[model samples]
Target: MRPIHPNAPGHGHSYSRSHIPVHDEAKAHLIASANHSRIVSIAAQKFRRRENVIARIRLVLRILSLLLCSGILIVLGQAVMVYYKHKDYVVKHNGTPDLRLWPRGLNMKPTLVMLGASVAATVASAVLGVASFSKAVRHITRVGNVVTVLFSTFCIAIWVAAAVYFKIDDFDKTKHYDFLSYTCARRHDQVLDNAVGNLGNLCAQMRASWWGALAESVVEIVSLATVVWAWWVGKRGGKYQKIGVEMLGSG
Candidate 1:
């Protein structure tokens, strides 16, 4: 029998074309897709981590502000009450003395404004801080940041006014009384001491309240800074995402 060549016309079997190029092309495409997915996943993870860190920082700052603002509110409330009690004593002791002679700067209106502003700040910070933990609600953090900044600004203004004007002309100048006179028991007149029991303590309380207001302002400023930081980070992250998408599309 003659040898039958594989490529002979009568041959029933023949070699198919090699599929190496097509296989390699397909594999390359698959690898490219996987790499793109991996890159995107990594980028997403980094973004989430950064976001979480910012959120946590915001939460801490807000909590601090909440505590400080609440403390300020409490101090102011006590000071107002103590002043009224002293007034009551004066009225009972002196037989309806002139209201004009009372302390100059402890007006109830301003005190109430301070109290109301503090309460507003406290509630806003508390609500936003609690919302930071939820991924679903975290989307609203940016809005919360804006709201926080507004609240902080308002609170700072109010607190600064209160601190500066609190009991401005109430202390006795004859005894060398200065802004901090009552704070340290430097002024001890018999009348005020007799009318307001523990007069030194009341003065100290007022001083503390003013200092707390200042402290609250400081915290508010810091909180506002954090909000700005968050916005910057978010803007940067958006740019990174845009760049990443361009790179993937080009690939």
Candidate 2:
């Protein structure tokens, strides 16, 4: 074979170092991509954790609201029972105790209004609470949340109205009837005393129901705030994730 020249096809230049930089660049690129992927994964995990936390908080609030409203409903139900019992007693006795002698205890209209509100709130809370557990019904969950918020608002208004009416009615009845002072003199008459006692008990129940309504309204407002906070967090996280994905894709 002829002696190979320096610049020949299979000569001194056969072993080349130019490919080293390309290899290093490829390795660096892979490492950077892997790091980005890890960062995204961590972010996603954190976001899911936060989302779960919010969901749990909301569920708890919903249950609490449900319980509160249920309590209110029970109280109002007792009031209604006492109210009807008093009417039946008066009719059966042919007004022997003379209802006009006693202070009017609970106004029927306001009591009914509060009762209805409690029922609505309780039902809404139950439905929404159940929906929250189901990830497959996201649309329904969103709609339920909106309905709950609306009901909360309406409940608050009605609660306030009923409470104010009760307050005003109580004041008027107290001023006109003056039953507290009359109780001493009427104690000798068993029927009158029993009638007075029954009315007094009914009034107490009404007061309790109105107070419970106000408390439930406050809980509803808190629940609404949590819902809004959860929504904001989810929206913000989604925006950040989108931005991160865009950045990774460009890179």
Candidate 3:
């Protein structure tokens, strides 16, 4: 008969190792901590068991993160187009949207500022999601779960600010209603109704920007909730207590 070691995987029936018990006071505490953190990891892992609620939440968060990225792209792209379209238009002696005057420059544009924040948050979310998915990189996922709340909060604020401004200042009840459709509407039409080419086209671009910003904001909020909950389900004491006990029982 071959000698059987306690740690061997298939020796459960032959050289049973269930008799051992952890007697070291200090070692027990350390093993418990490691096992607790392991549960947290599985809760956030991409290929985790489907039955676990935390794993399911993490999966939803992954999808939302991807949508958030797309939304960021749409918002930024529309903003850029609208800014350029009205580059030459003026409102009450005020020049139109331009990047040169944005923050880091003496003059700053609120919409542009929001756009920048949204872009950064989107990138952070993407990296965070990727770290969670890869599993191969454990440390990155841990760090990401820790800080994602901050970035997601930033995204939510900026998005809501832009969306609110769009609804209140751009559209109205009737007649003067400028945004005819997403593809066409007058930007500051109350002021720039005179812009030379296809004012409706400008309107469409602006509408797209608003929708994109709003959509991402909602998605980020949900993602934040899910991530926090996931951490909660993973970190609770009991999840790892069994593992720690098992480890102790193994030898």
Top candidate (TM-score): 2
Candidate 3 lDDT score relative to the true structure: 0.54
Query: Any runs in candidate 2 off by more than 4 Å, and if so which?
Result: 1-20, 88-106, 136-148, 171-193, 196-201, 246-250
Model 2, span 1-251: residue lDDT tens: 87768877765664465535787867776776776677677777876777677667766766777788888888778756654655545412664643443345623565566678778777876786677676532222476457656766776777677667655544563542222223323446656555646545555565677677778778768767766776776676677677666666654
Each candidate structure's TM-score, on Cα atoms with residue i matched to residue i, is: 0.67, 0.68, 0.48
lDDT of each: 0.64, 0.63, 0.54
Per-residue lDDT, model 3, residue 43, is: 44
Tens-digit lDDT string for candidate 3 (84-106):
55555544444645322111221
Error of 2 at 153 (Å): 3.2
Q: Candidate 1: which stretches are off by over 4 Å?
A: 1-20, 88-116, 123-141, 167-195
Candidate 3 lowest-lDDT run of ten: 99-108
How far off is residue 106 in model 2, in Å?
7.2
The most accurate candidate by lDDT is: 1
